[model samples]
Every structure is written in C-alpha cells, then in structure tokens.
Target: MKLESNLPKQSPWLYTAPLLNTILLLLVYFLFTSDFVVQSGISVEHPESNSRLTGFDRAHIITVAAGTDSALYFDGLRISQPELREKLKANREGERRAIIHADKHAPHGRVIEIGNMALDLGYEVAYSTVPPKS
Candidate 1:
C-alpha cells in the first residue's frame, strides 16, 4: 500500500511572511508615534514662559514674522494691515479669540498694535510661548 506525504509544500510568499509582518508593524509604530506639528502660518521664535495655558486650536492664530518687512500671517496667508482689519472685523461676529505668535526679536510696537486691533475687534488675545529649556 502507498502512503501519502505528511509534510505540505510551502510557497515562496509563506517564507517571507514573518519578515513582512515585522516590517509592517514597524511602519505602523513610527506612523503613530512621530510628532505631527501643525505649523502656524509664519515662523517665529516664541518666547519661553513658566505659565501653562489651555487649548489654542480653536483660537485664530496671528503670526508676526520678523524680517525686512516684518509681515503678518494668518492661516498661512500673508495679509496686508487693511485686510487684517477687515478679516478681524468679520471674525469678531463669531468666537472672538486669537493667539498671537510674535517673534522674540520682532518689533514690540507692531505686535502690540496687532494685539490692540484684535482687542478692539472684541477678540480675547493670548500670546503664544514655549516652555523654558531645561
């Protein structure tokens, strides 16, 4: 009497299954752990502070970028002062809260002027600050 083979033949894909699974797991781990920073419109060096604040996600962000022109950016768009005034006036109809991110070396007067404009438009302004280095 003839006996059937006990061992099954393995396919090429099965040989690489373990390695594929490990690679897939590592890809997922890095994707989940990598920090995703939402870049505000402009780049600025936020001053260090000891105070902790609440959410700024819902608040409008106004960035004061220091350079030759010292421009203002909102929602990643460079807007003129007149345009900013108009936008703020319109936004005041809704939740009037703003987060100002001014460069550490930016003109204090310009930043103050922007903050005052926000306030006058009924916006509750908050300055963005980073934690002091350890």
Candidate 2:
C-alpha cells in the first residue's frame, strides 16, 4: 500500500522572514542603545600658537574661562584657588603635571597665578593653545 502526503510547499520568503526580522531588530536596538558623541570639558577659546607639543600622559587640567569673572576649573570641576591647591596636594602620588587651558580673553594675571600655584606644588606646568589658522 502507498501513502500520499497533502502539504503545500512554503515560499522562500517564509523561511527568511524570521532572520530578516532579527537583523532589523538588532539594528534598531543598537541605534537606540548606543551613546552619541559628546564634546566634554569646559569651553575655552585657547590662544593661537605656532609650536606643537605632545600632551602629558597623566596630568591635572586647569581651565580658566573668559570674561571678568574669570572662573577657574580644576579637572573639569569649578574650584577655588585654595581648594585647587589642596586637591593637587592630595593627588601627588602619580606624575606631577598640570595643563592650563586658558581662554584667549581670560586675564593674564589669573593664568600666571594658577601657573605659579602649580609650580609651587612641584608640578610641571604646560599651557594649552590651538594651532594658528592658515
């Protein structure tokens, strides 16, 4: 005795639908979960310089903002000069280096003061500047 089957063959799309859906879902998931690029640090218009220097491997960043207020930032946090001194003293285990990011419009006296403070703390100081626009 011979037996006959009565099922219809499925289309190629039916076999691929789940895979396509999984790929599309993965794409959407990554698009929604991934972090976008953000510009970090205190905004400052650095003075132009012709010379280029390598950045320190491990250093404290002191940012001096423009305007009459002349706000001071130590390692991205707003801080007073004395507070900065204390913080620097506390973080003296590693290489002692300070990078000053001063705005072009910021007062020269304040920059000098911070530089002096860093020097007093026995830290090698370097000023940050942008390359001259050609």
Candidate 3:
C-alpha cells in the first residue's frame, strides 16, 4: 500500500535558521560589550599627533576649549580652575588619572595649568590628540 503525503517538504532555508540565530546573538553581544567612549559636550579641534595612546581609561575627562571664552569643562560642565582643583583633590582617593581633551586653538598655558593641577593632585595625566593624517 502507498502512503499519501499532504504537507510540503521543509524549505532548505530552514537549515540555516540555527546558524542565523547564533550569528545574530553574537552580533548583539559584541555590540553591547564593545568599548564605546563618548566624549563630553565640549567640542575640541584636537592637535594631530603621531603618538598613540595605550592603556588609557576615559572615566574622568577634562575638556579645555577656546573661542569666545577659554574654559575648562569637567564631565561636560563648565568649571573654574579652583573647582577643578577641588574635584581632583576629591577624586584623588580613587583612580588618580584623567584624560584631557584640549582644543588645538586653546591657550597653551591653560592646558599646561590643567595638567599641572592634575599632577599636583597625584593624578597620572593623559592628553588626547587626533590621529595623524595619512
């Protein structure tokens, strides 16, 4: 006796379902775990440099900007030199490091002043520069 089959055979595409699902899951995981550093509100025209940064953590960021007014911004908030000093003094208890994003047009003295303050507060200071042009 011959058996009658009514349902259509499964599509070949079904074979790749597991693989597609696995790839999508991995993509999502990597997207979330990737180190994505968002710069604070201060916009800076960073000076180009051949030097590369290594082992840098941007948890604490300071932005030195120049234009109508030269100012120091900490975590996106405009702050005075004394305020910055106080901040570093308090943060000294924890990680003693800061990533300074100083505008290329900013006064050289201001950048130096900030770095000195950080050093005085016992912080290992790091400067952020744009990658050299190809």
Candidate 4:
C-alpha cells in the first residue's frame, strides 16, 4: 500500500489583479463622482437646483464674462484663443471634464469655444446648468 501526498499551490498572492483593479475602480469612481476639491478663480453663483451637484477632477473652467468682447479668463488670468488651446493641451491628459459657466446674456459662441477647447484637449466635458427642481 502507498500513501499519496498532496501540497497546496504556492503564490497565494496571484489573484491580486482583480482586487487591485476593484480598488482602483472604486478610487476612480469615487474621485470622478465625488467633488471633494473646489476650483479657484471662477466667480459664478451656480444656479440653485435640486440636483445638488458639487464639482469634478481634472477640469478646466473658461468663464465668459458679460461683455461685448467676451473675454476669456482661465483660473483668473485673461487668455487668448490660441493660448487657451495651448494651455488646455498642456494641462489635459486625455480624460477630462469641463464645465462652462457663461453669463446668460453672453454670446453662445463663447461657450462653444470653451467646449471646443476642452474637446481638443481630449476631455469629457459637461455643461454646468441649473437643473430644474423635480
């Protein structure tokens, strides 16, 4: 009679990717959905609504003030169209989300320009608007 010996497989840490991926995904989910940081230099009293949304990560805000020229201010500094594009390109890292806050009276083209800039930077942009109360 002979007795067989059985040994458990080694490297129990092999199934780490799924757990790591899960942790990463959770971090990203929380980071993307939760607005923990407040962006500076933007001066718009975001309209009150029932949505109660806060903010985003890796976002570039282009404020179109109420004026005829429709000057552009990025982080409190005036920037031209070409320069704006350059800044967005340099700052963006493929995935992005931008919120446009334009004066209700401002030219629509101005907001489009901002969105275009974010698009050119490869960011997922979202327009910031006052959601109606449900």
Candidate 5:
C-alpha cells in the first residue's frame, strides 16, 4: 500500500523530463554535426604546436596519401590541383575551412603546396595533428 502510494501513475517519460530533454539535446547536437569522429589516413607523427583550434567541425577534408608517392586526394577521390580548386570554388561560395591530413614523413614541400592551393581557393587551412606518444 505504501509503495503504491509513493509511485505516481503518470507516464514514466514524464517523470524523466529533464533527463529526456538532455538526451534529446545531445542527440540533436550529434546529428547536426560530426563532432567525435575522425576520418583520415594521417599517421601518428604530426608536429604539435601551441596553437588551439576554435571550431573544426565538418570542414572539407583533403587527404594526401604517401603510400607509393605524393598524391592529392579529396574525400578519397584523386584530384589534380586545378580540379581541386574548381571543386572548392563550386562548393564554397561563402567562408569555408579545409583540413589537410598528410603523412607524417611526407615531404614538407608537398604539404605546403596543397596548403597554398587551399589558401588560394580562399579556404582556411588546418593541419591534422595527433597527440605525441608517451
């Protein structure tokens, strides 16, 4: 009798309104943006600087693979410099950003070339870095 009185007959979901709201908000956040997932072929040897990024959400991802040689890849599609620029120009009419994932041992010149090209296309460049191994 005491237990029955203590337990309300209302909907269980109603009892957890605050918790439900929090979970709903989190779901919406993750759905709207890619926050915790990383997609790249970069190695575990990026030089870390004292720089901190403000917001690096779903920016355009360009991977420069160093398997056989230096090759330009946009979202896994092989593209030339001019093609890359054209694609960027089409997709990015407003402010946009780019993330470059280069091999750890890739030549600096190649990486810089890609960075310069992205900058020339009016996209902010961000280098993908990994935490140093302990």
Candidate 6:
C-alpha cells in the first residue's frame, strides 16, 4: 500500500535558497573584512615622511629590507649589489626611474649606496615612505 499527501509541491530552489543566501552573506562579510594590500616583492616597514612624491613609474623597483646580510631585493628577488648594478645597466633604456622601497630599520648607508648607484646610472631615484600619522 502507498500513501499520498494533499500538500502543495515545493520547487527545488526553495531548499537551496537559504544555503545560497548564507554563502552570499559569507562572501560579502569576508570581502568587507579582508585587508587588500597591493604590494609586490619583499615586505618592509617604510619610514614615515611628511613629503609626498607623485607621478613616478614602478618599472624598476629595488627593495632594501632590514638587516645587513642578503637584504637587497630587485624585482622581488634577493640580489647582491653587483647583480643589481648589472640588472640596472641592462634595463637602461626607456624611462630611467628607480623607486627604492627601503625598510625603516635597513642600513642607512646601504640605502644611500643603492640610491647612488641608481643616480650614477642616470636613473631618477625616489624613496618610498609612508605618510606621517596624524
């Protein structure tokens, strides 16, 4: 024997509506709560400065990380000063701009040396710095 009910039939979407809404809510929550940092290459704590520089290209970027050993990075790769010099020499064409993202704790002399190298190569050098806190 079989039993039959007189209840109305429900669409399949009725069962999945709650789940879809929950997934959508979770996606929206994560998107709003997440931090989107768009920096590439080695991470470093930039020093704060009151001055601001604008309209500089990032084709050539050198990162000077903290500590004295193996702290130089070019194009996201750890490189030596000599290797950096060679790379800069190779890309001497087009817009000659070198943006240096030096860590606040990095050796000041080393940062200056890198800047000098870029300057000697006839590339306009700019140091990356965070805006001063209010």
| The best candidate in terms of lDDT | 2
Can you write out model 4's per-residue Cα lDDT over 1-134, one digit (the tens) per residue? 99876977868578887899999999999999767554546555444455554555556667776668877777668888789788777774543666666766667788787887687778776665567666
Clashing pairs in 1: none
By summed lDDT, the worst window of 10 consecutive residues in model 1 runs over 34-43
Report how far residue 107 has shifted in candidate 1, in Å: 0.1
Report the Cα lDDT for residue 89, model 6. Answer: 89
Compared with the true structure, what per-residue lDDT tens digits does model 1 show for residues 1-134?
99999998879998799999999999998998775454685768999999977766578888898876779987678898789999998774676788888898889999999999999888889988899999
> What ranges in model 3 sit over 4 Å off?
1-13, 33-35
Each prediction's TM-score versus the true structure: 0.70, 0.68, 0.81, 0.55, 0.63, 0.69
Winner on lDDT (1 vs 4): 1
lDDT of every model, 2 decimals: 0.85, 0.86, 0.85, 0.70, 0.77, 0.85
RMSD of each: 4.8, 6.8, 4.2, 9.7, 5.3, 7.1
Output the lDDT of residue 99, model 2. Answer: 87
Off by over 4 Å in 4: 1-42, 45-58, 92-95, 131-134
Q: Evaluate candidate 1 by giving its C-alpha RMSD to the native, one decimal.
A: 4.8
Clashing pairs in 4: 96-124
Q: Could you give candidate 3's per-residue lDDT for residues 1-134 as a string of tens digits?
A: 99999999999899999999999999999998785765777778999988887666655889999875778898899999899898888874577778999999988988998999898778888898978888
Instruction: List runs of model 6 lying over 4 Å from the truth.
Output: 1-38
lDDT of 2 by residue, 40-68 (tens): 28999989998766657467788999999
Predicted structure 6: clash tally: 0
Clashing residue pairs in all predictions, respectively, total 0, 0, 0, 1, 0, 0
Instruction: Quote the lDDT for 116 in model 3.
Output: 90
